[model samples]
Target: MKFSTYFNDWLYGQDGYYTKYRTIGKGGDFYTAVSTSKFFGGSIGNKAISTIQSGFLPSDTTIVEVGAHHGYLLADMIEFIYTLQPQLLDTLTFAIVERFPHLQEQQKKYFKESFGDAVKLIHYNNISEIKLDSAFIVANEIFDAFEAELVYTTQEGIRKNVVVTNHQLGFEPCDDLFLNAICDKYGIRQGEIALGYETFAQNLAQNIKKFEFITFDYGEKYPRNDFSTRIYYKHKVFPLFQEELNLNELFGKSDITYDVNFMHLIDSFNQAKIKNVSYQTQLKALVEFGIITLLEILKEKAGESAYLREVQKVKTLLEPTGMGDRFKVAIFRKESHA
Candidate 1:
């Protein structure tokens, strides 16, 4: 089986480890900016409200969150809108586009306790199923957890990597249109090109009819030095499954994600007729989204003693070498103007 197949199965399969694991936060494999600080989600909310005030997206536009991870981000967003733009809440729709069984349970509980009937839980198995006509779609750390097609480029030529045996995964020469397409698109050099993101982006584009789509992920639009699949368990790198040593990590019990290429994403969206694109670092995006003001509000609510803690929370999301520098935010406006 291919790595994507194995990966999809390991994470979402009925017998998958994610079904039994809480693989997020300080206690889990890794912490996302959303999980690290509630401010991250609140900042997203502020961005949404600002966009609405500026008429980027209509007030009645649906806010669809893809792969929301227990709906924590949406919770923050709902609370922000309630506290600041409560009237907008009545007109707007909060839709959580999710599929994971384990996450759904947690999301349902969170919604019940936090948001009540404010959110519309859309049950979707595929990303395509979660469609929108006019909305603002927030996909935080979404693109990274996707199927990546690994290609090996040698002096001879490009070759697609595949699983040959249980012991080792091997490479097959690039002779097909798929390899040619990727080579033409990304201008692959004599190194390695792992792309399956193109298809993923293209598929997502179809579902987005008209929206301000924002993606937060790690990696560049241009290919740099990236050649490894990451698996984290308890905040450490969990070794990939092998036939030799006993990799105790349960199948899909950890977080398996790869770097995202925003270049590939932009091309895909443009090809699909989505226009008006811009990119920025997470720090910049949050800054532009008014993270400082949001932090002050948090500080006031949490108290001065807790305010410093809130400042650190904001810093964690904005610091270099941590999430700030590593994480990138790409905003694609389907329309050039309101």
Candidate 2:
């Protein structure tokens, strides 16, 4: 089987890692920006409100989140938006695109516990199910989750794909024309190649006539020369192809992810007529969203000890060598309705 098939089954199939794992916080397999701080969502909320108020998006635009693991980010975004402009809540509808019924239920339960009847949330099984004239879609670490093919170049400049057989991983000459074409186009000789981005973008464009899509994930604009796939287990990182690591033992028991190729992502959305509005590091995005100002306000209002604790957590988000630089934010929009 191709590595992409193996990856999809291991991470998203029945009894897969995401299907079985319930924890995603400080104690979980890994930490996302959501788990790192509420302000991550708060910043997004601020941006959304400004976009709506500026006439860029409609007043009743549906706020949709794709791949909302446990709904923490969306919840926090709603909370901040409510605080910033409570009246906006009356016209906005919140929705999440979640494929798993169990995860959908978890999201609903969390929302109910957080807002009761104050906020009504809608759930969709996939992007194609979303229907709206105007929408503000947000996703964190989503593109990286799409199944990617592992490709490498041989000494003779021949491209080959990784395969799994008899519970062992090996490589064979690349036979897929599409995979070869993608690598050739991107000048990628050795790296993971994600498929289905074009279909995903097309689905969004077909269902939602007009929308702004923003996502945060780790990757660079240029193709990497080496593989960026890894497994996360118990907060420890394991390179997927590590010699000592047994792929069979970790199946359905750990988180698997890869760095996204932003260049390819942008091109796919562009083909769907969605314009790339901006691309920047997470650090810059947060600063533009006024996270530092929020902290200052907290310092003035909250006790010194409480403020200090939050500052420490927020540092994890802003540290130049950490998530701050590793993560990139990409924003796209289709303003036909405007």
lDDT of 1 by residue, 1-338 (tens): 66556666666677765566474787777888888887888888988999899977789888888887778888888788787788998888877777676677788888888867666655565667766667887888877766655555676654555543452556676566765677666775422344455565566667756688788998876875336566777787744533453333445566777677677777777776676367988989999888899878867787888878888778988998678888899998776332
- Model 1 per-residue lDDT at 48: 93
TM for candidate 1 is: 0.88
The candidate scoring highest on TM-score is 2
Candidate 2 segments whose C-alpha is farther than 4 A from its true place: none
* Candidate 1 regions with alpha-carbon error over 4 angstroms: 118-120, 158-160, 189-208, 238-251, 300-302, 336-338
List TM-score per model, in order. Answer: 0.88, 0.97
Best-fitting candidate, scored by lDDT: 2
- lDDT computed for candidate 2: 0.91
